[model samples]
Target: MKKPLQKSKIPSNKVFVIKELREAYLDKYWHSHEEYQLNVILKGRGTRYIGDHMKPFKEGDLVLTGPNLPHVWRCDNAYFDPESRLETHDIVIYFPESFLGKDSLQKDEFEEIRKLLARADRGLEIKGHTNKVVIKMMKELVHRQGGASIIGLLEILNVLAHSTELEPITQIDYKNNYTAHEKDKISEILEYVLHNFKNKITLKEVAELANMSESAFSRYFKARVNKSFSDFLGDVRISNARKLLQDEDLNISQVCYESGFPTISNFNKQFKDRIGKTPMAYKKDVIDSL
Candidate 1:
């Protein structure tokens, strides 16, 4: 995700903001807000970074993020199509945890809701049948006001609270304490790595991009992303390899080289470690499923 260039502050009285992003602009560096956020991606596809987890995003994807969890939604170039005049319609609902009502928090009926929010510190992706229902409810919430908004939000949470297929975006311990400046630095670093992961990346090169000493960069990178620089690089390469493996034309060896692995053995180990399967097995599974 691209860094947030500016910070947005919502007043305590304001419950949430509905933003329609139609331009090719970076939302801002990762930062947390006082209120929880429920984001529905109405259109467009790109990458989403919530806390320390980064993954591709697509239309109709709904995510709920807890308060103070850093997140970013970077839309693709097509999302800013001037000819279509279609802006990325994102429905964002922000509310303090207190909005759930004091009594509701104490009741067993809302236990799932509380658990869902607590788990949201790592972020949660709504999927399957729950996603369909929640997306529809969010669409309705967009046109509603006041009491309707509250009811709509509760309904959405209720659905999530009962969802068995909800996927967490990151580990429970993922830290998201990013100052605005640190967030910008980290985004630049990530962008540089993504663009160059197909080739060898040196510590000096990355440190230069951040304009920091190698040691300083190492500490800062680990602190911001919750992984070492090399681990982060390898993860990016493996993610791309997973995408390339879907193409039958690319054999295991081809994938290893194309994804910038230094050797076939190393690639196999990393792929299995990250994806929980050997490259050959993964390819076979993909083919068999197809």
Candidate 2:
């Protein structure tokens, strides 16, 4: 059994964190904050974990995460290059639901934004034209200070409200149990899994990470995440495999191995079962569309 990582806390009043990542490392433990989050990737590529969903992400990716949704951005190895000092800049916006005013949604002017936020419970991706608009707004947010930041945030939300290209990231219920201790435990478990997913992960290993026995860990995990451990791991693997498949340079066999599946047959079966398409077919579709 491995030990769990510590949880990181964000201040409630802060709207965002704009940071530069200079290395390819796991940034934080799997944890959730009270405020809704919007993350815009300025540079670099990596995997992103939101709730039960795990997928590869790259430059120009803009994601809106609902409150208390556990997530992490796994940066690509190129970020660690010594000569490339671009810092892998990421602009993140965080705000409470009340920032828009409790009655904002009741008013006709904000009803659309309110509805959009509701749909963001599963996480949302702003792509194409919408992503461009949001990225511009995020840049503005970084420069604004004082009350202007609040106004900028409202405007960003307004733009998102009108955009029709926002895509939901996952279908899993985003309602997380609200408790400090529970969030801490969940964060620890997630961090452990992300660090060790490439290798064999067992119930006992995760159970120990959560400081519980196998049986207890199973019950607690199910209760907190609404899915079993194995299912979650499979989802992570498939998501990674999808990303690998997009790279035509990698053959199907290479993708299966890199994604942590031990066999091609098993990878194909799980990929089709979860994604509704065979791995080769999925790869072909992505290539053909591009």
Candidate 3:
């Protein structure tokens, strides 16, 4: 078996593969392959990267990604601390988009599932009752054999196809500009942002990092990411702000400042614009859920 960090190649003879992983960190490099993927973080906290989207991920987060949508679940910095003892558990299922046979999904019985596959092109985060049920089924699936495994997969897919709880993680038209060198360049940019997003970031800085003129880099980034540099930065900042607000010690103003926003007014506006709620309301919702 290849080291887990390498881009995985699903064996051709298999219809799909399921893995229950317990590790210190996920794949360190960003890459993609031909198989569609459903990944659940059973016990972990990290920043998740999928195409142009970047957000924090934690336990119970379930995401379904279409084939060739570049992604990675990068563990928090503490996971790398030599004295820290932390691990991540993940349940991952990989199957070809046409694994059931090309004609199988063409039938009336599979119509919804076919559409679900199409929506997965931008990646979907499974949530609500659908997430609850499917995660249970997936847990049981890891121990099943042969036909049972296939049935379990179909059960999960059926729930996903019918559920309205699927949250698309990226812009509808986002597409990867896949090439080995380009892959590395994008990965470098993402990693840089992951570490530095708590501070102000500039397009000129990133353009320099990518070794391109600012105009050329702006066009290049917008082409692939389907958003301007500022919008993407806002998404990252708000995501972190929301996460930080979960702590009672961090008031809204503190969260705003700590998450890289210079003012509470701007933070409130961006938070509402991107997350559809004020930071206080969002924190309330999180509390109410508990």
Q: What's the TM-score of each model vs. the native?
A: 0.78, 0.82, 0.88
**Where does model 2 exceed 4 Å of error?**
1-26, 76-87, 100-108, 145-149, 170-172
**Deviation from native of the Cα of residue 147 in model 1, angstroms:** 2.1
Best by lDDT: 3
TM-score of structure candidate 2 = 0.82
Give lDDT tens digits, candidate 1, residues 1-290: 65454444556565555444544433534456767788887776556777777766667888988877777776544444566554566777777777755566658877888898888877889888888898888778778888787777788888888899788888777776777777677767766776567789999999999998999989988887898999888887886677677789988999999889999999999989988999999999989998
Backbone clashes in each candidate structure, one number apiece?
4, 1, 0
Tens digits of per-residue lDDT, candidate 2, 17-69, equal 44333434436556666677888888767778777677788778899988767
Q: After superposition, how far is residue 25 of candidate 2 from its true place, in Å?
A: 5.0
Which stretch of 10 consecutive residues in model 2 shows the poorest summed lDDT?
1-10
Model-by-model lDDT, in order?
0.76, 0.76, 0.84
**Candidate 2: lDDT of 90?**
74
Distance from true location, Cα of 77 in model 2, Å? 6.8
Candidate 3 per-residue C-alpha lDDT over 141-229 given as tens digits, one digit per residue, 9 for 90 to 100: 99998988999899899989999999999876677776766777777777787678878899999999999999999888777667887
Candidate number that wins on TM-score, 2 or 3: 3
